[model samples]
Target: MATTYRPPRLIIIPGLHDSGPAHWQSWLQSQFRDARRVQQRDFSQPELQRWADRIASTVDHAGPGEWLAVAHSFGTLALARYLDEHADTPIRQALLVAPAEPDKFGLAELLPQQRLRIPCTLIASQNDPWMTPHSAQRWARRWGASYSNLGRVGHINSESGFGPFPLAKRWVEVALARAAREQRPLHASFREWSFAI
Candidate 1:
């Protein structure tokens, strides 16, 4: 019998003020049935600790399975904080887009200072006001994530006309393929054992 492949569940972590109906993150959620957003208590004036806790708890409740996290703006910082503090996380891959400058929000101290173990891709715009391209590159290097430049697009958010971003969808598909490839060894071993019987 052929084995069916199951893609990792997607966890959408939106930025401050939350992703509205027009945001790509929200649109992506609508496309994927298993996708869910981490609900933060206060979206207007976000508290770092609270955001981190919410993210951690949501991931924990997702049980033991692969997870792909899509985090935007300040949500990237919160996801990083949760991953840095917890040794074990279900997240296998992360798509961090248009991350805000930690220093600008006085969150440099709260954000993770160390590199993350999870495979991540950081997509940033050249003209985002929240973070310069150079700063975005630096943060991607620090986090040991692959960096992609989105040209002169501003923030790559709803204002940037990314309500239903095709590029973002392609990136998610790529991540899913990569994650499946990485897990192939385990599946191969099981197949070998079954064939030996």
Candidate 2:
């Protein structure tokens, strides 16, 4: 049977400094045409409220199919906050990567963020200079997402040397396939004539 596919809406939320050209998020966006970065007020000064608002708006505006949220650094925490605060939306899955330490990073207020029903996965590195493995695991527990502890891969950003993550693509593909399966069937609701299956 021929399959119907809706290219997943990819929301890439970058943390503290916002992803530079060399960051993995930027690389992913260039690789996949549909991916986008959630516009932020300021990454240099890190504003949670602004980031949350932008994320929520982007999520709400999503037209169809599943939402695959990918976050790096503090972006992961921002998506977690959005998920916890809103009960409406079609975010199917999240891939949280390399979350920085809330305390050390001075984002202590966002530490106790709530969890949501969305399925998520956290990929963290053992020797990440910004965060501890144990802390990332804690984030996974609180967010109720599966955890992948990649050993000795510092931060998994371009700084740590990740240009095109083909391995990560496998995981993303599985998530997208699952989303296509669970998504509501698309219909020609406003069309006069539609192609027959």
Candidate 3:
């Protein structure tokens, strides 16, 4: 079924320093033609609204039934904040990795009980120098997002040594395959996502 809606093009938003050719985001874009980067004026500014506005701009341009946002670090938090305000927007899916901090993104609403009903894969690291697995789990549970800990791989960034994370591609593949079947994740357990891939 692949959702009659095109599940939007994939948009990659980086945090702090942008991902270069060697980073996973860059690699992902290089591998997937439908994938592209979300533009931003500055990554240095601590202001989350500026980044949020850019993300919103991309979302605005994105037609219905055709958007899958892949946000890393601060970008993930920015999207989360935006969702808090624009909860009704039609986004197909989201893949949020290591949200570095909350205060920086102004996502003050996320508590232990809040859930981000969208289908999401919140990847975390057990020994991340920037965050603890507990926080990541708390956030995932709060957002109703499934959490996957990549062992002790740190933040799962370039600094963490992940070069073309194959798991991400597999995740997308599963999402598309499941969508094609028109089966809601609520009735499924992401069991197909268990491939060692």
lDDT of each: 0.84, 0.74, 0.71
Better of 1 and 3 by lDDT: 1
- Runs of candidate 2 with Cα error greater than 4 angstroms are 1-7, 61-65, 106-114, 183-197
Tell me, by TM-score, which candidate is best: 1
- Regions more than 4 Å wrong, model 1: 1-6, 186-197
lDDT (Cα, tens digit) per residue for candidate 3, span 122-146:
8888897666789888888787777
RMSD of 2: 7.7
Candidate 3 vs. true structure, TM-score = 0.82
Q: How well is each residue in 1-197 modelled by candidate 2, as lDDT tens digits?
A: 95666767777888888888987788777766777678787788666767888898876676565577888888877787777777775776778888877777576576445455687778889999888999888877877777888899998888788877765666666766565554545632322211111
> 1 or 2: which has the higher TM-score?
1
Cα lDDT of model 1 by residue, 43-154, tens digit: 9876878899999888888776778889999999999888888777888778899998998888888877667868778999999999999999999899988888989999
Count of residue pairs whose backbone atoms collide, per candidate: 0, 0, 10
TM-score of 2: 0.82
